[model samples]
Target: MALPSVGTRVTYPAGDLIARARVLHVEPVATDDGERLAVLLDTTSIHPVDAGWPDQPADAGVITVIDGAALTVLDAIVAATDGETLHLGRDIPVRKGTEGWAFVVAHLVDAGSAIAEGDEVETRADALLRASLSRGHTACHLASLALNRALADRWTKDPRRDPLGSPDFDAAAIASSRIEPNGSVDRYRLNKSLRRAGFDATVFTGEYGADELRAAEASIDDTLATWIAGGGDIRIERDGDLLTDRRQWAADLEGGTARLFCGGTHATSLADLGDVRVRLELVDDDGTPTLVMTTRAHAPS
Candidate 1:
């Protein structure tokens, strides 16, 4: 079958939980004696990983047919093809607009299904689960900005700026960011290069007493509390619906607009967050210094 020539129109950015769509393609996938099926719909509300980033994982859901039959969507991933063969997940050869390729969301199901091309499937993501992930993702972003601000004084040299217009400590030092159900873990690297970049390494007070860490934690909380109470608006800005399209997290704060290029779900407003907090820990793992920030968001019932 010919591959889909255009990107999938995604509705998840608007907080859509369910969508009725036409099956554009269905292909059988086999790996190491195991088999799986990839289903592509004309439109989908299920958010897929960008393959490029993969920060926030896919939402849990199922596909329901007109006859009320359902197939549990075991996994959802971004697939792209160069008009030759469908490339699933990280196997995509080139970047998004490498000429003839079309990017799509590949909903993975059990192999040997009766589903075929032209079948209409109702796609639904678990709403409560989505909400929890959204909260986690949003809180993660907020914590990053706060952490950057708390560490801004360490960067002596002029560095890039963050969404809040502070020195881009987070962007420069960040290693990985993963979003979970109602929380997230962000890892940052502090190494010699950071010192070479004029970032004051002494700011990390492993040698300092407990009182200093507590004071720093209190400061971060104060900053977070102010931002949350200020009620910043959260919105995702995107260029297209394709899985690899450019998207950003825009937060409207008191002074100005704070935006970060992101591919994740988020709450509509800070008001949706009941209590958001973070715990910062500094650890030396295998001779490499790492900073871990754990963030949590409590949703009001």
Candidate 2:
């Protein structure tokens, strides 16, 4: 079968939990666990884990046919091909949107499965898991914005700003970000490079470090509390529906509307994220000072 010429159409961004699709391609792949079949679809509601910036993991789901047994979707990952070769996850060579490359979602199923190309199927993502992840992703962004606002005054020089006009400390020093169920964990590198970028790292290292950290955490919590109380509407805006299209997380925040480029599912409103808070701690990673922010939110009933 010929590889798809265009990116997969994704509907998860709109909080879609189910999709009707046709199998475009299927390839048997050998892995450490066992042989798995990679099923490519014409369209999907299952969210795939992006190799680049894999903060949020793939959605848990299954694919089925009419009155047929469901095939458990082991995982969904971003894959790309150049007509001649299909690359999966970290194996993808070129950046997204490269000319003549088709980026698609590969849903892995167990080996020796009965599914085949051209078959009509239904993709269903787990509602509870999706809701938890959506809430987590939304809380992740809100926490990062709050953290930036809390540490805005710690910059010694004029720095780049985020959507809310605060210093872009999160973007500047971020080492990694991971979204968990109902929460997120983000790490920031407070090294010489960050100091050179006008960030006053001493406050996080000096004798008053503990006190400063507490104050920052408190401030962020307060900001989050106010934002949640405001009950802002959350939405994902996109230019197109293709997998490679640009998308943004736009929220009608307290002060103003804030939009951040993102490629993950999210909650529908601030009210969906109940009681968001963060705990900040400093850790030494091979002699480098790293600040970790652990965010948590009470699941909405």
Candidate 3:
């Protein structure tokens, strides 16, 4: 009737490219770029950009109304309502699962869209792009795990462990992660705090730093190759169907089942990853030394 009291039910995690949904509310939102119509749906297969992580971006898609008029979805983003007010993206004031707020996916269409509240609609995500992003996202996670293992010996002190039981260097140092078509770019901050945590940064800073980096890259590449060769099955497990519901990327590897909390779409199995590889680079960000890992994969044809 009004803004929903619960989160939007999401279907993309299950690899659905299309979904039938009902428009719960339609309102015009004034953004920095201008005004746009925000359509709140009862359910969606279109993956929206998460404001908190902003890693894997919103899926490109379109919504078809009953009259067969297709409205191009310019963007989709996470939106929330506290019963009285609606907030979008970074404008949301409270953390997810707050006492009374409902988190939903807001599909942005042109202000001139004739779609209105209570309309039944069908949302479709571009199949090719979805496949590419899924591959990139899966590769990104695998690459992070491989990199952590490659750098495990450098952590002198006991830090947290990842799903694979390696020192969680990726979690501890990651500054930002972005998923691209058939690839991903992740940046980690190598600062004083990392050294203070007993990470042997000297190896990456010493005269033989180049050699050490090359060794690490080779190790990571080999690990990925082995994992891919095993053809481990991959799937997304979820606690519920809602947008804010807890979901995980679960991969059944040769070693064991590794599960990481994730909110992105992924391939159904490792066989869809094709060849996953990553290149490591050390860059300077302002005055801080940063480690940038660029992961790429051949898209599954």
Candidate 4:
């Protein structure tokens, strides 16, 4: 169909499980050996993976028609537009905010499905899975900040500050961050440049994994405990209701607040994140040092 002019309306921000929407556009996307169909709707509840930061995965959901027929929402991703064409995923030629471009969530389905433009569609996200991922993502952020603080004294030179204004070790040396169901794994590279950034590798290399990790967990859990006990709100702050709107994960701690520019779903408060812990491991890669932080959490019963 013709390129979409605007962005898709997403409903997952408010913990919506389903939404009634009108299909605004559909296109045949060619995959290996087959053709897949992409559908755009006036509104949806599925969380699409952003092209820039894909920390949390997409929600498991299904699309249905008013007649009770359902189509599996196989995959959903952030798509961009320049008014002249619709770009899917990393294929977007220009960066976001490249004047006159609209961002959207492109819901992909099997080609030749009966779904078409203007069809009233219902999008639903798996609530259980969403909750697990939410916990994992929240834990990930908390753990990173705590880890940075735990190693704050190691940085001799001034470095970029994190949300808490400490030396941003996590931001500097982070190699990869993957959020799993109720847990996350983050790796930090200890290369020459990281040494140049003034990160002490000995804490992980020589003999500081267990003690440092335990200390980090204690600090983080303490913060989370205070936040949970204080009963403040935790929510996703967004600029617009559209798919590519600037959003931040905001948490109101008892003493202060932490706001990170984020594009993932999160829990409502620290109460929803129960019993969080982390494990730090040191692995050497052909004479190079790597620190892996594994964070896990269990939601309250």
Q: Give per-model TM-scores.
A: 0.94, 0.98, 0.98, 0.91
Q: Model 3 segments beyond 4 Å from truth? A: none
lDDT scores of the candidates, listed in order: 0.83, 0.93, 0.92, 0.81
Better of 1 and 4 by lDDT: 1
| lDDT tens per residue, model 3, 1-301 | 6888888999999999999999999989998778999999999999999889999999999999877689999999999999777899999999999999999999999999989888989999999899999999999999999999999999889999999999999998999999999899999988988888878887777898888888988999899889888998999999999999999999988789889999999988888888888888888999888889999998556
RMSD of each: 1.8, 0.8, 1.0, 2.3
Runs of candidate 4 exceeding 4 Å displacement: 32-34, 207-231, 285-287
- TM-score, candidate 4, is 0.91
TM-score of 3: 0.98
Order of candidate numbers by lDDT, starting with the best: 2, 3, 1, 4
Model 4, span 164-214: residue lDDT tens:
777999989988888888889998888889888887766666575668656
- What residue pairs clash in candidate 2, if any at all? none
lDDT of 4 at 157: 85
Error of 3 at 265 (Å): 0.6
lDDT of 2 by residue, 55-148 (tens): 9999999999656668999999999999877899999999999999999999999987888888899999999999999999999999999999
Selected candidate, larger TM-score, 3 vs 4: 3
The per-candidate count of clashes, in order, stands at: 0, 0, 0, 0
- Cα deviation in Å at residue 122, candidate 3? 0.3
Find the candidate with the highest TM-score and give its number. Answer: 2
Model 1, 200-232: lDDT tens digits are 766674576345446656777777788889887
Residue 202 alpha-carbon offset, candidate 1, angstroms: 2.1
